[model samples]
Target: MKKTVTILLFLLINSLVFSQSLVDLSKREKERRARLKGKTIIIQKGGDPARKGATLKTDPSGLAEETEGLDDLTSLDRESPPQKRMIPKTENPPEETGADQKDATDLQKLEEQLRKAKEYVELLTLKMNALWQEFYSMDDMKSRDEIQRQISETYLNLQKAQANEQKLQKDVEAR
Candidate 1:
C-alpha cells in the first residue's frame, strides 16, 4: 500500500511538469517546420522574387538557361584578341615642378591666422547680435549700460579681426 501511494505521487508530479512544458515544445516545433517549409519553397523557386507578393507559380528554370547564355558569351570574349597601343611622354613647363616647401609652410601659417581671425569675428558678430537683441527687447535705461558695453567690446573685436586679416593677406601674397 505504501509503494502504491509513492508511485501515485510521482506520476502526479510528472504529469504537472509535462503539462507545463507541452505548450512551449509544440510552439517551437511549429516554428521549426515553418522555417523548413520556407527554405524548401525558396530552393524550388531559385532566387528570391523581386516583389514580396510575387508567387513561385511561374517557371523557375530560367536561371539555368541564363547561365548557358552567359557561358557562351564568356567563351566568345576569350576567343577574341586584345589590342595593343603606343604612347609617348612629353616635357612641360617649369610650373610642372612642385611648389616650394617653405611656401607651403607659410600658406599653412596664414590659413591658421585667417581661421583665428574669422572665429574672433564670428564671436564679435554674435556679441553684437545679442546686444542689439537686448537693446530692442528692453526699454529706456534698463538695458542701456550692458548694451553699450557689448557694442564697445564688439567694435574692438572687429578691429582686431581686420588687422589679423590684413596680416594674413600680406603673408599669402608674399608667398
Candidate 2:
C-alpha cells in the first residue's frame, strides 16, 4: 500500500510541475492562431492619419468653428475704455466690533478651561496609578480597601475631566 501511494504522489507532483512549465513564444503564438482560426479578425486603425500632419483633436472631423457674429478678431486690440483709479488701502486696520471681541474672550476662556481639564485628567491618572501600586504593596486588608476606594474616586474624577475637556474642545472648535 505504501509503494502504491508513493507512486501516486510522485505522479501528481510530476503532473503539476509539467503543467506549470512556461511554453515557448512560438508555441503560444501557434496555439493562439489555432484557437482564432475559424473567426474573421477585424483590426481597425484609429486616430488622425499620420501623413496629413493635422493635430489630433477630440472634436468631430468635419465640424468647423462658428464664424458668425465674430465681426473681426482684431477689434479687441484697437482700444478699451479708461479704467477707474484703484483706491490704495490705508494701513490702519478696522476696529473690532463688540461681538467679535466677546467671541475672542470666550474662545480664550474655553481654551483655558480645556487646558485645565487636561491637567486635571493627567493628575487623576497619576493618582490612580499610585493608589493601585500602593494597594498592591500594602499587607493590611483595610489599607488596601482604602486605597481601592481612592482609586475608584480618582477614576470617576478622570472620567469627568475627560468629558469636560471634550466639551470645551468642541466649544473652542466652534469658535
Candidate 3:
C-alpha cells in the first residue's frame, strides 16, 4: 500500500511540473514575420497621421468665407462674452444684534457649566476607581458591600454630570 501511494504522488507531481512548462514562441514569431513581409508599413513618430496644411480664408468684410458643404466652421479668433456667476450675493453683512449678544452670553454660561460638570465627573470617576480597588482588597463582606454602594453612587453621579455636560453642549450649539 505504501509503495502504491508513493508512486501515485510521484506521478501527480511529475504531471503538474510537465503541464506548467514555458510556452514555445518561435512558431508565433515566424508566423508574424511572414505576415508582415508583404505589408507596406508607414511608421509615424507620434503614431498620428501627418496633417495636411490648410489655411482659413476670410472675405473682404472680415467674415469667414464659406466652403462647399462646410457651414459649421466659425472664426477661431472671436472673443466670447464673459460668463455670469450663478452664486447668490450676500449684500448684508452679519451684525451683532441684541438677540445675538444674548446668545453669546448664554453660550459662555453653558460652556462654564459644562467645564464644571466634566470636572465633577472626573472626580467621581477617580473616587469610584479607588473604591473598586479598595473593595477588591477588603476581606469583610460588609465593607465590600459598603464600598460597592459608594462606587455605584459615584458612578451615578458621574453619569448625571456627563448628561448635564452634553445637554449644555447641545444648548450652546443650538444657540
- CA deviation > 4 Å runs, candidate 1: 1-99, 140-142
| lDDT, model 2, position 41 | 18
**Deviation from truth (RMSD, Å), model 3:** 32.4
For candidate 3, write residues 1-175 as lDDT tens digits. 9999999999999988766652335667566556444432211122122421122344444344323232322111111122232556579947789989788768767877766565556545656677778889999999888778877776777778779878887876787
Give the alpha-carbon lDDT of every model: 0.52, 0.58, 0.57
Score every model by TM-score: 0.39, 0.46, 0.43
lDDT for position 27 in model 3: 62
Select the stronger candidate by TM-score from 1 and 3: 3
How far does residue 22 in candidate 1 sit from its true spot (Å)?
66
Q: Pairing residues by index, what is the TM-score of model 3?
A: 0.43
Clashes of each: 0, 0, 0
Residue 62 CA error for candidate 3 (Å)?
86
lDDT for model 1: 0.52
Cα error, candidate 1, residue 128 (Å): 0.9
lDDT of 1 by residue, 13-69 (tens): 999999889988999977755544422111112122331221222233322212111
